[model samples]
Target chain A: MDIKNMQEAELKAAIKKVMQDNFGLSDIADDADFIKDLKIDSITRMELLLKLEDEFGVRVEDNDAQNMLSVDATAQLLKKIAG
Target chain B: MASKIVVTGLGWSTPFGCDLDQAFDALFNGKTATFRTQNINLDGLYCQVSAQIPRNEAIFPFEKWQKELPGNKASMFTIFGLEAAERALLDAKLIDQEGGYVDQNLKIGVVVGSGIGGLEDHFNTSQVILEKGANRVSAFYVPAALINLLPGHIAIRHKIKGPNQSQVAACSTGAIAIADGARMIVEGRCDIMVVGAGEASIGRLGIAGFCALRALASGYNDNPQQASRPFDKKRSGFVMGEGAGILILESEESAKRRGAKIYCEYLGAGLSNDAYHMTSPCADGAGAIAAISDALYWSKKTPNQVQYINAHATSTGLGDAAEMSAIKFIFGDCIEKNSFAVSSIKGAIGHMLGAAGSVEAVATILSLHKQKLLPTINLEEPDEFAYHNDKLINLVPNNGIEASLDCVMSTSFGFGGHNVALVFGRY
Candidate 1:
């Protein structure tokens, strides 16, 4: 929950909201994995990344991209960058 | 001896999205890109909802969509094919704006197919003539939508000077292109082949034409989202889809020399015709069985080895059952009758017509990569008309199984009983 930590829960909530609003992914629970559990697939994940880049103001590299697979991971990264 | 054909790159444009990676990504995630469009601004015609590819005027120059002026739907396929080819080549490490991948000695080919072609555009042009006048009909109708030109334009633009061709087998158009391209590579005609299918037939004329033939789901119009339910009891005809799917096919030697990224292996292809009726398959599944048998034969593998099969189950009354019976006959009682990793993307994407087969091919590749398989979305109530053999355990929807599936085969049959199958195996 620390503002300095990038992988915070709030950033994850914001991303899940974006996915739900744009791509209609309502079934994605917090514990859901991006590729298997949340089922965001690869393309939408890219789309989601594009949205995140705009929202959180971060330029995620391909190496960093795959690591931000889960909402929690993305949140943690986002908070670290934004803070 | 036939040479080995490997897939180095694949590019697809769908109602889901225009980019190749984007479509492949979405297919794995189980997403539906369907939506309603009432484009009253452009002449006020009631445009029925469709999985429409948003025309990026920059990529698809409006002028290019037309030979002379005012583009039509047929040009949509041609335009999309060109863009996809570029992307595929880029993916294949062949040629890109970055200019690094093409091997000078590599003989390249292009195969783009369409199920319905520019029927809606051609049909709309006819309507415009009746409503307004003959002169109002742009002089560009014939040049735009003819099915043959889908590949012609792509070849002309990219200067793809090798075995230039196209396929048209109704919904199986796109898959046939891949199969055909694989054949070209195996036969040593080309080192690299660009293959995919495209369609832009979602206009009123296209849907109305299918409606006239009673081949579309009319009852589910109220709920468009649920309209394309495949393999369920409440199932009706397929929902018409329009778009293109392209793949970069190359020989393994050529790909390795160039250091290209390979997605998977195109093991083999099978193609056949029902020779029965225009649109209907042999009700007993004879034609489908023949096509599948040929595919397996070409693949040089027994049915038991293929862990998963992406079926051409369009959720049609006779087509789905025919395919099931065919699968039963080929796989025998033990496998076909059991609950396997059998499924269809049409249930989610509707009938993509020509684009159906190629995108589904992508799904199969992803299946091999991730080791997961999704069930047919609307397959809740199991109807065993053609699957009379107890060996067939119908896979239910919403539940995908994760397994170490190695070889997966995909089937696509078009109207006029044109049948094609592509076999894929793990690398």
Candidate 2:
């Protein structure tokens, strides 16, 4: 699941699924920072990291949590973690 | 320092029964409603045993106000507390006889305590992340799971307008709820207050979490009654129980003016902390002593004046001994004698945690009226800490028999090192 390597359409769907699943938000705005805009508290973000690993079948390095700012940034980080 | 307060009404939802009188009767006759769980799937767990109340005991039917509350611990507790409060207010005769307990004239308040608020809510919501995704989560999840909302829901439904708050200190929550309501009465903040604690954490996450900490007993899966032995030598760990115990506290002046039936006087309360560990107490028992000593001080009575102590003895490895040492500190030279009637119903009800304090307070008040010591069952052999188990009961063979009761005290120590004690006596 290298989110960056995936085609544009597939990546959008995957990000959509991840945001919808992890955050429980019916709507995910494109410019949304997964942390700030969603109001996902620190614990939830850590939980998000765990979910990412569980869903993507990858190991999210500790440093990757902070770099996971925007939903787009999260999609890119999945590429790194997946590698 | 403050005006006198009286217990005008009482309510409880327990494994024994729904109403307070029924529960008390079942409790007195030594009937424990605990049974082995054949329902929920709890495979990888430390304690397969639980003291679950019958499902039918739910105060309100489905599609009631709880439908608006959502599926969570708060949803369950809100419903339970509402039923308890409804019964309590009605019993106090504050409401209309034709309708029920609802009086617009009453200046009422509510204090509902929760040990761990809505653990089930969070656990179920977390699953939405795995299954339906984030958007599938309930919008009302945050409000439904918040610990403070127990009182919030109660106040919203009943329109209680005085002091409203939630007390949380793990297991000691219920005891603090009563004391806080007492303070409100003494301060003249409200004429009447409905107070109690509730928890509904009996799920896969709850059992798994406790198992993770190794804090639940795994010994008596075959027989649930024998599972929780508080002061016994072979006592392993506490059995988790859930429910709510509510008491209506009113000023003596108010109760006297209204001619309400009185249960007992809410004398004094004490609170302290071990400040030692996150979950464990300091073996020296400094916090426990401070709480008991202060409660005695508030009552303006000597330890000798006390006749019974409904101890917060959870029957854990260190907790039971810590409580004994604290009692020794308060009773001093008196504890060695047949000093006071003392027992932990945790052996019977498995430890009610959040509701333990209020439920045990009800038990202590019953002792004052009935004048008999409640037994700590499941004790085959007493441990080093409690050799006086048999001697704990003074008025013999007359369980629930009325006798002279000067004063009694109840104690609760919770997580984050929170400690509280309440003293009561006849009006």
Give me the candidate number with maximum lDDT.
Answer: 2
Residue-by-residue lDDT tens digits, candidate 2, B1-427: 2378888887776777666666776666666655675477898675888777667525234334334333232456555555566666677776654124346777789888888878877888899868967755655568777878878876766667778999887889999999888888777778898888877677788778877877787778878888877677888888888777888898888899899999899998998888789888878788899999889888898999997788887868888888877886677555557656666777777777788898788778777766766766776676776634334433221133345687988889886788899999888
Worst 10 residues of 1 chain B by lDDT: B40-49
lDDT of each: 0.71, 0.74
- lDDT tens digits, residues B40-61, model 1? 1223322243455655553244
Report the error of model 1 at residue B349, Å.
0.5
Give the per-residue lDDT digits (tens) of candidate 2, residues A31-70.
Answer: 6876667776665566566666666667676776788876
How is the predicted docking of candidate 2 categorized under the CAPRI scheme? incorrect
The local lDDT score (0 to 100) that residue B420 gets in candidate 2 is 91
User: Which residue pairs come into collision in candidate 2?
Assistant: A20-B133, A20-B134, A21-B133, A21-B134, A23-B134, A24-B134, A24-B135, A25-B134, A25-B135
